[model samples]
Target: DIRDPARPKRLSAVADSNFSFWHSASFNNDGTKMLFTDEWGGGTQPRCRATDKPEWGADAIFTLTNDQMTFRGYYKLPAPQTSQENCVAHNGSLIPVPGRDIMAQGWYQGGVSVFEFTDPARPREIAYFDRGPIDATKMYVGGSWSAYWYNGYIYSSEIARGLDVFELLPGGLLSQNEIDAAKLVHFNELNVQDQQKLVWPASLVVARAFVDQLERSSGLTTDRISAVRQSLTAAEQASGMARRNALTQLATQLESEAGGSSDGAKVRMLASEVREIANVAR
Candidate 1:
């Protein structure tokens, strides 16, 4: 612990049987979980071919609690690469999507992948970009070395090619509002090695994003979801106290219903965000 930097103290440490080279690691926005990436081949060997085990050269997830960590599971690139590609986990950063633990990371020659580990035991890929190996018949150490999300877009540092940028598009797994909400979280500077706690501003986009999450999870009834959307729309169209009053009313209603909702925590978060929006509305 760095409680006293003059003399550092070690809290706890654990080992996993699957890890080879502990290349890098990162924590979720809330610090409740941590992810460690294994670079088995040092980014110069073919470690992501069909013959490789998924647990090798993969991300090992662990849950953090009371300064203790417990292994949860492992996540690797779902698609196998050819023996010609030098692929292994490298560097990555979190995508600040509220209420979800999403990440965008690079594999040596596996390109870049954006995935979610909200349920640490069952991580899943949400989006990815991959190219054929540099040489189809021979191994090549040319692919993304780092993939990080900054501002509203993802930037990948390609080892062979130059820098690559990406704009996240709305799809079945993620929505436009969620994207917008993520965009609201801006940083003057970012260091992938040092994880930061992401926070979204009190904006209509963020409130709506929370609502969308509730709808996606069926956290609220269809009628209630529809009504909340309608209210938000109306508030957006109104001005002055009219807007504030509408949001305030809706937030109060949400607060009252959250206890009975399936996703009570999310509903309460929605309520709190909406209430904050009402506070700043003009």
Candidate 2:
């Protein structure tokens, strides 16, 4: 479904293959090429796993042309014989780096694998960070989900936890040295509680101060505030209780800030109030 305001067209398609179930798809930076996942391999059903027989062998990743969806090539994951259900690129994102040919793919239970797609037609796996071993038969799950290259690091969404950070380096296919070089920066280990304490209240206080300044400069009345409050209330309803409470608190602070006579003093007071709030919240 195209939910964007600029494009409101609905898209639908039919597949010929019974096993054809496109899980996720993404396009290149320039929208020239596209990549998609097909999870119809390794004895697994398209979306269900009823049979125990491992008839299907391997999940495949396919590259396609953006304009016509023309078949380009396929990257069949290595099927090592083990209790593990083999690596399947379930969901992934293309990182657009100027000099890099790497595409970060999320492998279910296989962890995050980076591929050197220099030869686009025949992409090769360069580095892989396995989430390590776990009880397979008991339903071993969890791996990289969404990944984005920002500030020279790959930020991955580890749905089971939070975010896992990694960095890429020069490497060739299946290079353990390259993979080891990439470190895992676990957010939880880095004083996450303290960080949250510092961030949440500060953000609310700053937002409140900004809204107050806008109101003062625009000479907005209670009627305008009521209208914006209504919109905010609707947004809160859509967002849920926690967000609504936070927003309402910010609005209340903004109202208080506007009551102050001096602009600089109001900002300073807001900052001080935020620090107090953070201390209490923490």
Candidate 3:
């Protein structure tokens, strides 16, 4: 906690009793929560082996309250790493996703991991990228140093491989709407230590992305996807309040039948977004 630019003071510190070594940390946008990583066996140690404890080289999420931090849980790379690889949490940063707590982090030879930690105790990876190790035969002290989310893109600085850039695609555990919404968030200035708060606005593009997500996830059948696209197109092409009402009605029907699909909740959410878009058009 550096309150003064020149004179930085430590408010509180956790000891080795809590873990082994403190590597890096990231706080939520509000600064109400903190996530710290444990460098158990150092960067060159393979703490990600099958026999390694999850807490040894993992991220520990803490809920901060009135100068006190409460340990929430741990988030480790689920993938097993070789004893030769430097598999431990290094550095990471938060991705602004409204009320959700999502982060993209770096793990030496473990690779870069993008995950959600809305429920600190139940963090899960959504997207990741990893290539063959520095050398398949041997693992030296070379891997990603930091993986952070800046603006709408993810940047990774490797020790030996140089810089790596990635664009998070909408798939797996995320939807197009979610990705689009996340991209909408921007920062004029970003300092890793001085994290900024994020706010997102609702818009038509977000609604379209939701519909796209539904289609991509197969949440709706091909016929249903086509019908939904046609309806949205017609609503867009139509004129007057009549068109608005028509779109609203279609959205209402979709919302009402949301329970019928495997992704019912998502369908309901998309329907509501469509309805909101219709209202905006009106």
Candidate with maximal lDDT:
1
User: Which has the higher lDDT value, candidate number 1 or candidate number 3?
Assistant: 1
Off by more than 4 A, model 1: none
- For residues 1-282, write the lDDT of model 1, one tens digit per residue: 998999998876879888999988788999999899999978898888889999999999999999999999999999999888989988999998888999999896899999999999999999999977898977667999999999999999999888999999999889999999999898999887777779888888887888888988899999989999999999999999999999999999999999999999999999999899899988
Clashing pairs in 3: none
Candidate 2: list runs displaced more than 4 Å. Answer: 1-19, 40-66, 79-81, 84-87, 99-101, 159-162, 172-282
Higher-scoring candidate on TM-score, 1 or 2: 1
Task: Return the TM-score for each candidate structure.
Answer: 0.96, 0.45, 0.71
**For residues 1-282, could you state the per-residue lDDT of candidate 3 as single tens digits?**
567879987676655455788877788877778898988878877778899988788899888887788888889998887877788888888876544578988888888999887668788898888774777787687777889888889899988889999988877577666777878888887777667767655555566666676765688888988888788777778867977897788888898778888778678877877777777775
Please give the TM-score that candidate 2 achieves against the real structure.
0.45
Q: Mind sharing the TM-score for model 3?
A: 0.71
The models' CA-based lDDT, in order, is 0.91, 0.46, 0.79
Top candidate (TM-score) = 1
Better of 1 and 3 by TM-score: 1
- Per-prediction backbone clash count: 1, 3, 0
Alpha-carbon runs more than 4 Å astray in model 3: 1-18, 205-282
